[model samples]
Target: MDTDLEILLTNDDGIDSPGFRALHDALSEVANVVAVAPADDQSAVGRTMSNEVSVEDHELGFAIGGTPVDCIVAGLEALGPAPDLVVSGCNTGANLGAYVLGRSGTVSAAVEAAFCGVPAIAVSLHIPEEEWPREPAVEEYAEACRATRHLVELAPVRGVFEHADYLNVNAPIAGEEPAPMRVTRPSTVYEMAATQDGDSITLRDLTWETLGAGEVDDPEGTDRRAIADGEVSVSPLTAPHTTEHHEALDRLADEY
Candidate 1:
């Protein structure tokens, strides 16, 4: 409790979400935590950012009326003491795979923190579709929080951030025993489709459907597969898209 390591806590599910509170209280055991999270749910908003947002003081920390990215930027620059780390989630649903990386607000908050030079961990709990109809007990989030606390306390000191900008972590809802842990990579599987019906097109992400059926095509050593196997999946990642010098692109540019 006397440690100087400060943590900025947030979630795409918003400030009042049970998952958020569970993680916040858990992380508080490891570091000083500030909750600069959205006042309302901002799920699947990705890295959508706002130039300005309203902030209010809450019992846990500052609540902001904006996107997850907004909360990260605001927290790092204006809301609290500059954090040693940023932890987003204990999200109600999992955020997995390469295609999903750009569309999950929980992961985007971690991405934003990475760009701002703070190490981060984005967390989610994998609750099956049938179970999602009911809100999970706050205690169920303990499994994810347990794993997160370990990473928060150790990753920095271990020089993990030298290679990874942030970590995307997903875990299954707790059962009688703690779930196993796996270091994984994002799944390469992509399964989005759109169907046109009369006046409008309905878009669907089939990956979640595959997950619900426990039949995803994700291979071994992948985030999706680890979560599917009821293990905590931790994937260390870089943010803001890696740029490489490409002679082919240079030639195409010269032609242009």
Candidate 2:
């Protein structure tokens, strides 16, 4: 346990949510972990930030009445001391694939941290459909958090953050036997769908259904496939947008 090592913790789920509390308690065992999560649920809100936010001191840390990104900026800049690493989630659902990277608040929190020049890890649990509509117990988060704590312990010294802006990790909900860990990349497949009704346009993330059915031909080393195969998926990712050389754009500019 590196008591000297500090961690800034935040989540899309409210600070009091079982998953957030569970992870906070679990990581506290490994380092000086502080919670600066939202005061209310902010699931799927992406990297939205509030112009101003309310902050209240809580037993674990501060509960920010704002988005996960707001919590990160507030925590790192004003809440307390700068932390060695920033960790987001232990989210209730798997945040897999490239389609969800920008949409998941848990993942977005990590993205915000990377933009703020901090290495981050976004963690989530893949709760099976059988367990839907019920809260997962704190104990249930144990195995998933084992993967998280291990990464927290080694990632800094291992030079993982040197190359990667952040890591996106999703662990299967705990089973009698802990699942194995796998290195993966975000699957590039996009399958979002929407149905039009007279007054309502229903949007569904078809990817979830595909994953639940184990019917997705998710390729060999992608995050979704690892979760479907009962393994913890760890994806090292760079934060900034990349641009490739484009001859078409060059010709267009020349014509102009």
Candidate 3:
């Protein structure tokens, strides 16, 4: 048995979600997985932390009344022993592109864990809005779960966590087996447009609708492009605000 392997599972889609359930069951096969996820969908909530949170016992695991980040924090500090890794997602929708990272609660949970010095992975599936069912799509999500399981099995041996704090993975819908996994960077180009209607302003994300039109100037070999080409994208990401030497700042400080 892999006694050394332990994983903390979480998601933005809530505890009752089939996506979370599928991932938890799959992860349990290889690693000791403990799920502590939101009680309700908290997608796009980002890294927001609440002062007070409520937790309830559920059939799958503990349902948390907070953002995705809270679930990871609770899992690590309150649920059980410190896990060897944190895995967030199998999210209902894809969390791709550079701009989406700051807005995706699923990916943010992994980012939060990375900040705590724990290796993490955020897995999401790309689905066209038109194809999305009225209800949650468990079967499609399960396909992504299979990929997640494979990554979990190979993560340790591949040394994926060596240089990266966390990995952001977005897999296209399964057809044959899977196209191929590509190491990529998040695309900077986005299609976030806002419309002002009276006093209320509505923000509409047009990435999906416009991406097919070749309307975006996003470079190739990016997360978006990888998924666009029906390949899995594995973007190794670092924690918030990576530090770099600033000559101008240093000079200013010296003068002061």
Pairs of residues clashing in candidate 2: none
Over the full model, what C-alpha lDDT does candidate 3 score relative to the true structure? 0.84
CA shift of 86, model 2, Å: 0.4
Report the poorest 10 consecutive residues by lDDT, candidate 2: 128-137
128, model 1: CA deviation in Å?
1.1
TM-scores, in order shown?
0.96, 0.97, 0.91
TM-score, cand. 1 vs. native: 0.96
lDDT per residue for candidate 3 within 111-163, as digits (tens), equals 99998889999998787667654445566665577778888888868998888
**Regarding TM-score, does 1 or 3 come out ahead?**
1
Candidate 1 ranges with C-alpha deviation above 4 Å? none
Number of clashes found in candidate 2: 0
> Candidates sorted by TM-score, descending order?
2, 1, 3
Taking the tens digit of each residue's C-alpha lDDT, what string does model 2 give over 39-59?
A: 999999998989999999999
Model 3 vs truth, CA RMSD: 2.2
Off by over 4 Å in 2: none
Best first by lDDT, ranked:
1, 2, 3
